[model samples]
Target chain A: MKVRVSVQLKPGILDPQGKAVEQGLHGFGFAVEHVRIGRLIEMDVPGADAAEVKARAQAMCDKLLVNPVMEKASIEVL
Target chain B: MRVAVPVFPGSNCDHDALHACGTVMGWDTIPVWHQEPRLPAGTDLVFIPGGFSYGDYLRCGAIAALAPVMADVKRHADQGGLVLGVCNGFQILCEAQLLPGALLRNASLRFIHADVHLRVERADLPFTSALKAGEVFQVPIAHAEGNFTLEPGDLADLEARGGVAFRYCSPKGEIGEAFVPNGAMNGIAGIVNVRGNVLGMMPHPERVVDPRLGPTGGLGIFRSLAAALARG
Candidate 1:
């Protein structure tokens, strides 16, 4: 099974990169009001059941992929 | 003093650390590889130098924190051994859970490389024994993900435990928004674990240890380590 994990800075944590991107969009005459940058990780997990794979992926996020203190991660079974 | 400096694959400052600790300070320093599963016997201090460990993959220090050698590093720390992490090393310590908080991207989203002033918050710790409280020192800081962040409760606990060792401040020793290079919480530049043996700081003390290099303000850190070892 394949899993996708999206990791983002927790709310109230400053997102400077996202703000820079928002400013760049404004400079280019785009109407992008708010921008928050994040990371998307796709990985192939060895499992037959989707539920099992999702759980394993979530575990991965908790352990290594995401920093629990500063980030929130959501896993999707693909 | 026997110092063990672990060299990760992408570690760039290992030699500098060796020079500062081994040559300048004349300590018995060993450069251990990350692949090694054990630290040398009688290791007094484990120094993690700054660099782009594992190319900053999966977040700074995330991958390097799990290297084979880290098991021994964790063991060493658990036994109340002294560990010092600078810049990238600081990131690794946090990732390894040897220290509190996480270093995030700079508030400006840009890599900052410059000299900043630091205020010694607590001088009683082993790392700051050479400096007095409220003293200011100029040090070089170069990093992108150097802003330290932690949960509120944990932050309070860290403060209550006297874990904060250094704080960013102005050249004249005033701390405020104008002096904070990165948006670190409470302007913290360095901290110690609850055990007070491990220290993690964003500034490169090794870079400023020599007077010819720049300010020798950083010499106190190495001196403190040596003093700690001598006292033991």
Candidate 2:
């Protein structure tokens, strides 16, 4: 099974990197807006069960991949 | 005082912290690896230093926050042990929920490196006992993400409880809009817990401890902590 994790800064947390990216897009005249950069992590797990895979992924995130204070992460198993 | 400095993979400030505590403060400072399950015995102080831990992967301080050593650090804080986090260390403290708020990327959207002024917002905390409230001093901050932010209620709460330790200031010590260097919310640059045991600040005091580096105010942090430890 493969699990994908997406980590984003919590709603109230200020995301300067996202803001800068938004500004950069404007500077480039992209007409694009509302950009927020997040991390996408993909991992291979031994379990074939989707629930098991997601659980393990979350455990990894909590242990080393994500910072709970400023970020919230979602996991999808395939 | 016995100081424990955790060395996360890629952490570069462990030596700096150790030298400051071991040499300058004349304390037994232990450099604990992230994999360690607990701090060495008789630890009076714990320091998380600045560096691009785990290559700042996932997010700044994200990966390192979950290291085994953090559990012990959290326990130490719960037991009222003093914890001082600087720069990246500040990010880790916030990640661990030991401190409120988060450090966002710099306002200029670039890494900032220079000496900036800070006004002591709370001198009653053990972290700032040597300084007086409203006193302005200089410290060097080198990081891409140093802009501090907190929820509206939390920000007010921190101020109301006198947990705010420092605020950006101008050379002349004038505060408010003109002094904040990186546009941090409410001019916050550092803070401590209500218990006054944990302190998280963006400036690198260890880098400025030596007079040859330009400012001595930075050295005062370690000196104050050392004095408190010695007293106990």
CAPRI grade of model 2: acceptable
Candidate 1 segments exceeding 4 Å error: none
Query: Once superposed on the true structure, which residue ranges of model 2 sit more than 4 Å away at CA?
Result: A10-14, A23-29, A45-69
Docking class of 1: high
Question: Across residues A1-78, which tens digit of lDDT does each residue of candidate 1 receive?
Answer: 878899998997888889999999999999996699899999888989998899888888878999999899888998
**Full-model lDDT, candidate 1:** 0.92
List-wise, what DockQ does each model earn?
0.89, 0.48
Query: A75 in model 2: Cα distance from truth in Å?
Result: 4.0
Each model's lDDT comes to: 0.92, 0.84
lDDT by residue (tens digit), candidate 2, B1-232? 7999999988988888887778766888899999999999999999999998999876678777889999999999999999999989999998888998878777777888888898888877767778888888888888888888777887889889988888888877777876666768888889999899999998888877766546677876887787788788
Each candidate's interface RMSD? 0.7, 2.6
Winning candidate number (DockQ): 1
